[model samples]
Each structure stands twice: as C-alpha cells, then as structure tokens.
Target: MTGAESWAREQGDAYISLVSRRAGEFYRALANEDAATFFKKPL
Candidate 1:
C-alpha cells in the first residue's frame, strides 16, 4: 500500500474513534435517532 494508506490503516482505530466522536457531536446538535447517517458515511 501507499505510505498514506498504510499510515491510515495503522491508525484506523484512532481514525474511527475520532469519527465517532464527531458523529456524537452531530448527534448532540441534531438527535440520536438521526445520527446514523453521519456515522454510516465514509470519512
């Protein structure tokens, strides 16, 4: 894999953690029932 892709894969867990946190922020702004859209989309 390319260097960036390898790095991302190595840090994939961290990336997902951050994305979940962001989704939580969005959920707080909107509502829990509708937050799936944010979480399901690829970052």
Candidate 2:
C-alpha cells in the first residue's frame, strides 16, 4: 500500500501527509491495545 510519507513526498502535501501519518500511527498503536481497551471506543 502507498504510505502517507510516499504521497507526502511525491505530492508535497504537508497537511494531508501529517494527518495520514498520524492516522497510521494511531491504528498501529490501537492494534497493540487489549480487547477491553480496544472496544472502549467506536470505530
């Protein structure tokens, strides 16, 4: 899959890049969370 960094560098869109990157990091962090915590919030 194309990453935010790739698109950021290619298109030079800093804002979208930041958002995409943070979204990725957020999801990655979420993956490591326990089921109880994971289900704490809605998707």
Model 1 lDDT tens row, 2-28: 465458788764332223554566744
Alpha-carbon error at 40 in model 1, in Å?
25
Predicted model with the maximum TM-score: 1
Clashing pairs in 2: none
Pairs of residues at least 3 apart in sequence or in different chains that clash in candidate 1: none
What TM-score would each prediction reach against the true structure? Answer: 0.26, 0.24
lDDT of 1: 0.46
lDDT of 2 by residue, 1-43 (tens): 2575577779876533122423556755644322232224667
